[model samples]
Target chain A: MKRPFQNLVYLYILAGLSLTIFLVHCGLKALTVTVPAQAQVDERVTFVMHSGAEPRIEEPGTYTTQLLAGIMVPKSWNAREQAVLTYTSPKGNGTLRMIPDSEIEPVSGVSWHQAAKNMFGIGPNLVDDFEWIIYRSTQSYTFSNNEDIDFNVQVACNVGSENMLVRLGFYVGSSIENLRPEDDQYKKFTFSDVFEVSGGEGDVQDFVNPQLGTIQPVRSLDNDIITLVFNGGVMNTVLDGLNEVYLRAQAFDSDGQLIAEVMEQNDKTKMGSIGGRQFRIDIWPRGFFAIEKGKQIARLEYFFTNADGTKTVGYGNTEEPFRYTFRCE
Target chain B: MKIKQLLLFAFVAFGYLFHASCEDEMANVVTDEPVKNITGSWKVVQLTRNGEDLSQRLNLTDFRIDFKEDGSYILANELPFVLVGSGAYTLNDPQYPFSVLMTADGESEQIAVKLQYPVVNGKRQLSLSFSLGCAGNTYQYNFEREN
Candidate 1:
């Protein structure tokens, strides 16, 4: 019995030893490890895997390079009639005009390749057929979606006093299915019918809508854009001499909810030009209107305020006030 | 009985030897060497944003970062603006994946960056990778030590 007990002790010790070995092995594996120092830095390390082959770097005189260069040229340089180039190819010959800026027009039968070569000096084989197709498709989509949907109004203001403020307001009338002025129902409208506006300069102040009661503020009526041009130039001394200028516009939708508000102001110092002379103010509305296919009437209001609390105001009914009625088809 | 006692002794001895060997191997793997100090001007050779090459975005062909020994850095470029950021840097791990931390002067935020020092065309290059607070987007900048 003593001998058997000794053997049993040996077995128990073996099992315990095996268990300890296994535990130690696992513990070592779980411990955090740092990479060997010698293999740390590599010269050809790749951090990002691109989806495709690397893009070729742009080269000088390439088609794309020349195209971008042409676009960056001043528009006034291309506007001159002397800038036109005449090109002749095996297929045809035509006058390549760089008018209208950034665009080259080839006369009747001249191939686009010949025009591009003559105008931008880009070789005909530079642009592949696939690229040409994509370019043409994009141009088609832009021209097709953009039709005669723009309504423009230009106003000229002559500020007689140096300490005067000018204000312009636009109002949009009720929506009609057809924008044509010949519609008999249009004549029945009056100034009271105007409730919304397309575009203007400042935050919409409170306005009493004839049909909707006193709306707190008005918003843009549609996506239509309105711009004010002073003296057909961006800067004029007459506008710069003013002590202060306030430009504001507000538009409301059919549901009488304010949609857009634009406000701009310039003090005397800010109005002065680079040469210390006064500059005219130009209002350029940069956004489009969201008007549906329909007819609408718009009203314009102008005001001039003197530094001494005196004012000059003009309404849509005033002689030659800036206003228009148009249709969107 | 004597055999049984000898076997037990052998097992215990082997275990001690194995444990000692593991400890020594780990010590070699993580050396206690001092971190390298990198203080000098560096020029950006390549810049990639979200895996796209944007090295030409800034006209900085002559741009360089001057790192003074006093822990201040000056970013000088041919562009219109010059930026100066002061911070301390560290290259704690000299091996494969290195850790670097830079803190701008007057800013508590620390920018954590990973870098690798690789030799290419017989010239040493410093490549750093970090995120610009974009979701899952990272920028990798490769620079050449100017001085």
Candidate 2:
């Protein structure tokens, strides 16, 4: 009779254990799992946790230790104990969801601070609001050589703004490099507000370089003109060591039509200040002839007479002619 | 004792749920191809200015340029004056829209010009524009491939 009773007891215990296991598994699975809540614009969310009970909110990854604030559980909590959390958002009341961090795509049209915090889980420490605005408003281009010697030119401009900055970066094959203004002789490589317009016609800005000669952009009112001033000062410098020079300008319209031609003549009397290096020539798209705003000025062709005047110094006649496109506002 | 065992089971189940929700981040990369060589002869087919056609102004016949592989070029102008000039040319960028630096023979000065190589009517052509620093003039040249 006692052996039968013991067998019955053992059976009862086994049944109880199985029931407990099933209940525990079901209870854990039933633990509230919610979808990620989307906060409305300018909304604030508050999280509340019960005392002495902590919830472990691990980052959504196999090996990420990044713990977000307010949701992370403390080690002091009981091993088997789960914390009770209540979260309230000004936008709406919703259950917090457990989704992988990677699934959180940044929403557009939000403040930079909010975007940074939501996407990176860090504050806006790398770039501030002002800096971010400037970055968004600017356009930049970088040019470099692939050779062993490092030479680079970086230009940045805020479009529609009045200024542009150009920087030259040079590095030898070795490691050390420094950008020193003193080492820059020609100053041609550096320019500030190079594209700024003085607003009216006849306003001129001169670019001086010992190696490159003087170039001036002079604005004229008649045809919305911007004349490239290349006079004896520039010619003498360009043809310093040579004798006899032939100079010609070929002007074209926006339709690629040749409209005007100016050739340097041998008759010094007709040429303004014959033997004087000073010369003024109009670029394309002037006043009434100007292309609509934002359209590039007509292209210009330059031909220089060789020292012998027997031939012209430029891209060969059969080869492509050299061209320039300048635009005025 | 029974409660302890249930807690252990619950913990294990919760751990599994957390691990199943993760995914690996994906990466995407893009690349660009470099430009081709522009070493060849080009003939001037049209010359224009300010919405006007001035092809008759300069003799377009026998007007051609020969660019050698060595960066040396010869311009043959067969008009008013039959002149042939030779010079060194340097291309700043090895790309479609690039600047050309031409130095006349025996002259150190370089005249910089921008050019674009485009295909027109199934023929390779070079389109260029420049100003002679004149008061109100610009020139456009369209050159077709000769060789």
Candidate 3:
């Protein structure tokens, strides 16, 4: 049994302890809570047109890059055109050539070793039987299926030497597809890139051009894609409700150095609503970065829903990629 | 003494809560309903465009419409010119001075009107104005209240 005064004193001590614990708890919370700082978003870039033949990056500016064509420059040894190239690295001198089109006959009656000498300026340890076929088409052409962009690059180096490589650079151009007559927003320009390789590697075939923009929906309404039509181009996928979609656009230079053309992400409507409902998401382009000039970008709208949830539905208008005149000032 | 004090506190709290709820309910906004007298059919007297009268006067001897609050509307000119069509109508926004959105035959049209102020002896009136255009010419039609 404690006296009233003692009870009061005990209460005061307990309150003080509680106050100290509360302060410490608040300090811990303050340390753990993180408020995001202000971030700068990149401006959305649309494709633009400019001069100069070589693949050049204009000043800090935005431009649309499309795949124009897939070309195969076959191996030749007649001295008029040389596909085989020789390099003298620190390890030793080696030879290599742009893959030969198997359709074309080997230099008449020349053995594989002799042909290697004429093509690469040195003999190859092994001659791959695979042939190279370069694919080529302008933006006006549409692909119906996923076809292979094939190539065969042969390389060789000093006997028993490890640092030898065959550096084959493939530069391709794919045109932007589907541009409507009404919208003049972007001038289509076909871009290029250099893709390289090295060593005593055998035939490299079916090398897909990576520098083209591909239409892939982050999410489709009803799992059904909305078929968007680019006036002169092809329709890949569609936009739908509650989706975080991604699309890829790529471009390469003359040396086969792949210049990636990606959605800068700053210009996107991060979250869009239609038919009256809010959904959580971020939308971006994804798939093969393939595009061409005069092609319209169309989205195929579709959707998906929970097995027991309400029916997932979608509806809205789509903005197709249009061609406009762009001049670099 | 404790029970009496507890009852007194509970009674006072209940009274305050009831008054607060009543005050909250009264804060809602109410819009004006359509005039009861303006529910009949009216004929088109004239059609004008850009201060000039047009040749095709609306042949409305056969035109008729009946609007009722029981979710019903009838528009029967059942001919090639005007097929009988009826549907429900909803006021999209009642804050506007005088506007109506009508849906019939699965088609919706927005209508803007001018209303006469001060309901005289429980009777109100309004006017229908139509902007007409034909063959590069435009005009306005003013239809007075029939009743």
Query: Which of the numbered candidates is closest to the native, going by highest TM-score?
Result: 2
Better of 1 and 2 by TM-score: 2
CAPRI band for model 1: incorrect
Which runs in model 1 stand beyond 4 Å of their true positions? Answer: A1-329, B1-34, B56-58, B77-84, B92-97
Task: Write one digit per residue (lDDT tens) for candidate 3, span A140-205.
Answer: 222222221221212211111111222121222222312222212221112112222324233222
TM per candidate comes to 0.25, 0.26, 0.19
Fill in the DockQ of model 2: 0.02
Show where candidate 2 strays beyond 4 Å.
A1-329, B1-34, B56-58, B78-84, B133-135
lDDT of 2: 0.38
**lDDT of candidate 1 over A145-211, digit per residue (tens):** 1121211111111211111111212111111111223322211111111122213343222122111
**Relative to the unseen true structure, what is the C-alpha lDDT of residue A51 in candidate 1, on a scale of 0 to 100?**
12
Q: Write the per-residue lDDT of candidate 1 for residues B30-136, one digit (tens) a residue.
A: 56665455568888887764344646543348767666777666766442111234556545554434866666667677666777777878877777776532223
- How accurate locally is residue A108 in candidate 3, as Cα lDDT from 0 to 100? 31
The Cα error of candidate 1 at residue A181, in Å, is 69
lDDT string, candidate 2, A35-143, tens digits = 1122222222222221110112122211111111122111112111332222222222222222233432233234432332223231211111111100010121111
Best by lDDT: 2
Between prediction 1 and prediction 3, which has the larger lDDT? 1
